[model samples]
Target chain A: MKDRSGSVLRLAQPVRLWVQRFTFLLLLATAAGLMLLGKADTVIVERIRVEMTDAVAPVLDALSRPIGVANDLIEHGRNVYGLALENRTLREENARLMQWQAVARQLEAENAVLRNLTGFVPETAATEVSARVIGASGGAYVRSVLVAAGARHGVRKGQAAVAGAGLAGRVTEVGDRSARVLLITDLNSRIPVVVESSRDQAILAGDNSDRPRLDYLRANARVSPGDRVVTSGIGGIFPPGIPVGVVVGTDGGLRVQPPIDWDRLEFLRLVDFGLGGPLRGQGGAGDPGGRP
Target chain B: MTPAGGTIAHRVDAAAREATPAVLTLVLILLDVVPLRLPEFAVITPSFALMSVYYWTMYRAELMPAPVVLALGVFQDIVGGGPLGVGAFVLLATHGAVLTQRRVLMRRPFAVGWVGFVGVALAAFTLTWVIMAVLHLALFNPLAAGMQYVMTVALYPPVAWLLLAVHRSWVQAR
Candidate 1:
């Protein structure tokens, strides 16, 4: 019996080894096939990504609340650390700014009146979905984030995702309970942007870098560094006038620099622009051209 | 006990033992999904799951099968938001390398093992980087890949120690 078992083991060992080698090669082949398949129809991959995101979004949302609290606590701690100096500075500034506050309040009241008279409505109605960033696509090739929001929370693909400070990115893949945010710094991310001062239109392109470059700038456009860049609301992706980033420098004839600190991204607010169509809703009634 | 009966029991015992590694793999998968915010050194957060698999495959090769490694890799790919087979490819390769080198690794000193880990990690990182480059040619940046490689290597010692400690305790308990 022992001799028979020994012979069987010896014969089986080579077969097992061959199977192992074959399996490894098979996995490699499958990986190559997937790469080719993914490239063939990018849309299918995007759809699968969305479905996966939507499915996992709720779990991400649950996880985000604690992150949000932790962020608030950190911010509060920072505030506390500078409270003594801030208190003294604020007290003197308040004494001087009390006069300006009245003017500011007056202007705000007047602006409200004008908005009412012109039938100006904010693009996104009050309903907002808050999500927590669970994981980051920390690879050099992709600048996407996995957030904890999905179909249950009304987070759909193509929705604008913004951080606490300003625009972060947009939802590209939505699963049942989770979604993926393709940040403005991703190679594939592109936003229709307008230079705040000049209103010069261009496409903000992400090249898998911290600062996305602005492309398609018309020749002789008067865009300069330090100019504000906002969504143009042309592509029906993001709402108009949403702050994206500040123009830091013109690189290769492209305006660059993001307003939001991409490195320290933690939480995000997915904006729900009420208008289900292009953000260029009939310009607020007051402006003859409806241009903000 | 009869010899024939004993052999069958032994086979069942081996199969049951395999389940322990599967449980460990699942726990690692859960850890990958959970955003456990480590205070410092966040960028180079050594992949705990990868280390766990590596350690188990080295000590308990029979239990840590190739299929489990591939499945875990797929799970990581989905969670990490990379192409589906990228992690699987990296991990299967790592498993194969570890298996081939296990006898030497087991006999080597701690320092030698560390060097072996560095070599393995470098190979894995290179493989992953190459696959990612092919997937996104325009987006591939060597500097970022280098930084990640450095972080992974720098992090391996501490991660290896932790895995060793866990293995020791688990083995003792068993």
Candidate 2:
């Protein structure tokens, strides 16, 4: 009986090994198959991704706080170290800004007069919801940040998120109390941008880099280095004239150097232009030639 | 205590013992997303989950099976916002490759295992780049993946040390 049982066990060992090998290969195949399915970017896969993010968010939030506090402390130390030099620079800048404020008021009056003459309708002021950033990405695959405010705080999808410097990103995914801001440097992001100085339109396309490239410029589109890039509002996804970045690099491969200090991000302001998009309802195309 | 209650308690303890690999893998995955607020920690950090999966499977192949590794990989991808199934393919491939060479690896010294991990890291990163590049139909910048692979390799020793401690404390004797 013992000899028979030993032979049975010996036979079972090979079967177990075979099963293990089969399962491993099967999993690999499943993974490849799932990758193919994900290519379509269907609603189900997106929902799953969002749900997964939501599930993992709290644990990550708790884990990230201590690190964030340490980061803030280091930044504070740096600021204190540079306080003297920074204060003098700020004082000079403030004085210069005051003079510019006077000029701006004068220009405003002249612009209002011209607007009255031309019967121009100014854009409505944008409403905003301020929120703290909960998560910032460090991977090249996706450039995004998660904000604590979501639908609960009036943070809607497709709204522009801005930092102190310039346009940060757009709200792409929103849960109950959190939303993901796909930064302008993400490979998938394409912001309809215009050179604020020349008004030459182009698309700002991110290629998983710190600087994004410009696309779709007209022939002889007189572009030069250091020109400002702003949203064109052609797609109606973003409002016009939102400061994006500045053109940088040499003649051939010009890129927009965004004003974002990628090292430090704490809070963002989400601007919800009530109309949301041009296709949504109001046809405010900014067409001066249309019948008024 | 009654004998039946004692037996039930003993079974629960045994079950918890069995779940250590899965639990640790899950925690490592949670750590995967904990954004370190350093500029250098930018976008691609070390693969803590991968290290743990590889270590646990190498040491206790029966306990850390292919299904568990596959599940952990999928869970990590889901949470990490990685390309779906990419984790599974890479991890399962790693598991299969290691399992085949387990006899040779188990006989080797600590230095050999560490050296072996470098090759594994390379394969994992290369596979990731290929999968993503093919999926996107564009060439991905290898710089990030290369950095990630280096970090993963750098981080392995400490992570392996911790896992060894856990194994010694909880898993080795019984």
Candidate 3:
């Protein structure tokens, strides 16, 4: 009986080891299989992700307030140190600006007279909401920012988000107290844009890079480096004439140096342009005859 | 042995064994998500999570099971915005590689084991690059990927030490 028991014990050891190893391998196989199969329908996943992001945006915003304050304090100290020289420069610029302001008033009077003669009326500006950027979705992929204001603050999906400088991107996902703004640098982002100097239309395409590329530019388009780019309002997604970026010439094509510094994004403005209105039939607000 | 004492000992041994693998899996997941940016070495970003997976497989294969490692890889895939099985395949192969050389690695000193880890990480990263290239039909930029690998490799030593400390504490406490 003792000899038989010893042999059985030795056999059981290997059996147990094999079972453990097999079980582990099986689990890994299942996880991989699930990931591949589960991610097949990204549209549904993206919807859910947007909703979740909106829900958490406000909480993140509250938490980030202290960091924002600290940054502002440091910036203020640096600005104060250079205030004297800056004031001197600003005084000269102010005098130059006053001279230009008088010329601008005269041009505006002349332009209004021309508009009256042409029966043209300017569209009223839309309501605006100011929001603070609370968190950043920093990773190898997915360039998104979370802002404090959301549905409660009249922030809606597809609203044009901007910073102090110019157009940032559109709000793709919104929540009750927060929202996620997809930056123009994301691979999936595309915008209808026009060259400010030449009036040539082109599509701005993001390829997960800091500077986005301008596609479909006409061969004879008179675009040059340092020319400003602005939204053309072709798709009705964004309002017309929002400053987008400056054109930079690349080896292969033209790139846009976005007006908003994506890396150091802190605050954003969501223009409540009342896009869900009779603006579709009215054509683009900025266009003279409401024609494409 | 008395029946009551034997049962208690058996229960304690099973519980201890179960806890080891669970703890290691949690550590691996945590390392995968925490963003550690080093601006000085612009080209190379190290992945600490990959190192953890490699070390645990070599040191305590029984505790760091293949399946958990695979699951971790899949989670990384979803988070990294790539095809789901990419991380899974890379991690599965890495664990398998370590398993094949388990006996030799177990007896080696820390430095030899770390060097072995670097080799394993390089292989895993290369495999992932190939898979991505095939899927996208574009040549994966070696410089961009190499920078990430360098960062991940640089981060391995401190993370490995931290994992070791945690394991020791858990084992002693148990």
Candidate of highest DockQ: 2
Residue A10, candidate 2: Cα error in Å is 4.5
Alpha-carbon runs more than 4 Å astray in model 2: A1-10, A109-119, A250-252, A277-292, B1-6, B171-174
Lowest summed-lDDT stretch of 10 residues in model 1 chain B? B36-45
DockQ preference between candidates 2 and 3, better one: 2
Better of 2 and 3 by TM-score: 2
C-alpha RMSD of each candidate structure in angstroms: 7.2, 5.7, 7.7
Residue A12, model 2, lDDT: 82
Candidate number achieving the greatest lDDT relative to the actual structure:
2
Give the per-residue lDDT digits (tens) of candidate 2, residues A1-292: 0233346648887666666667777888888888876665556776777776776677767777888899889989999999999999999999999999999999999999999999998787788988876666555575777777767778777789999879988887777677778888877788899998889999998887888889998888888889999999886788798999999975657899999876566788999876543232111123343321
TM-score of chain B of each: 0.77, 0.92, 0.80
DockQ for every prediction shown = 0.35, 0.55, 0.18
TM-score of chain A of each: 0.73, 0.86, 0.79
Candidate 2, residue A136: Cα displacement in angstroms equals 3.6
In model 3, which regions exceed 4 Å deviation? A1-43, A47-142, A145-156, A173-180, A270-272, A277-292, B1-48, B55-103, B134-140, B170-172
TM-score of 2: 0.88
